[model samples]
Target: MDLLATQQCIKISQEIGWTEKRTIETTYEMKLFNDYLLVKKEKFPVTSIFDISFRKKSQTNDIGFLYLHTNSGVRTYFIKEEPFSLIEAYEKLKLERPELR
Candidate 1:
């Protein structure tokens, strides 16, 4: 990530009370490897999430949607106008992992 994006992510993490442990950019800042994405937060176990979907949700701004399947259920996260970095990452992930499609 770039310096500005990294700063924004750090600010967001602080806003949400996250300690910023992982390098991967998830809702909870969990570590992610090529094989799997890790998610371990309060009220959540150390689970690996593979089911992920990204979509452009708004045309007015660089808004996007991230759908993730957790242990309990699927969750949706909205990416606000910030140049669509997450969407780009998702697209790259899709290219690397065809099974995600």
Candidate 2:
């Protein structure tokens, strides 16, 4: 798959804590490929992606979430930066190749 774009994001790993809820996060480069979305070795096909949405950062959360709703299930990626560019690119690719859908 050809690389279209890349976004820097965090991948969250939660742990139960007594004092407060805790999460371990790792930075990952999310690659937007011509035919798939790849992050941390997991790949999701562009055709399976049904929609994209943003879960805004709130008081409790420090970062926003980029949601990829796919035919199989939803994949959430944590991000501190704006995802408008990524969404725009994804939409454009999907539109350019409707046969993938």
Candidate 3:
């Protein structure tokens, strides 16, 4: 994994009020969903990872969505939106990677 990218993600998560915790080794998958941003992570030995979604439903719907899943378990979380500009960055990335667009 890219340490710099991970750190940037961490910083963005922090800005959005996503609780940061110390854990063992883990992996992450991030993507965009509609106007929302999704971040998923799985720790070693875990069959499934936690899915976190962030979006602005309204001017006041700053809270985002979070989904946690294990082999036979699932959970959800509602969190405040982050301050980092995800949509802007996504647009920039799309422009840079036209083939992916």
Best by TM-score: 2
lDDT (C-alpha, whole model) for all candidates: 0.45, 0.82, 0.39
Candidate 2: segments with Cα more than 4 A from true spot: 13-24, 58-61
- List ranges where model 3 is wrong by over 4 Å: 1-62, 65-77, 82-84
What's the best-to-worst order under lDDT? 2, 1, 3
Q: Which candidate, 1 or 3, would have the higher lDDT against the true structure?
A: 1
Q: List, residue by residue over 1-101, the lDDT tens digit for candidate 3.
A: 21111111321332223665543323244454333344555232221332323443555545454443434466544444452454455445445554434
Predicted structure 2: lDDT: 0.82
Across residues 1-101, which tens digit of lDDT does each residue of candidate 1 receive? 22111101111332333654543344434333444443343232223344555566557555465566666688765554443453355446657766665
lDDT of 1 at 33: 44
Best by lDDT: 2
- TM for every model, in the order presented, reads 0.35, 0.76, 0.31
The count of backbone overlaps in candidate 2 is: 0
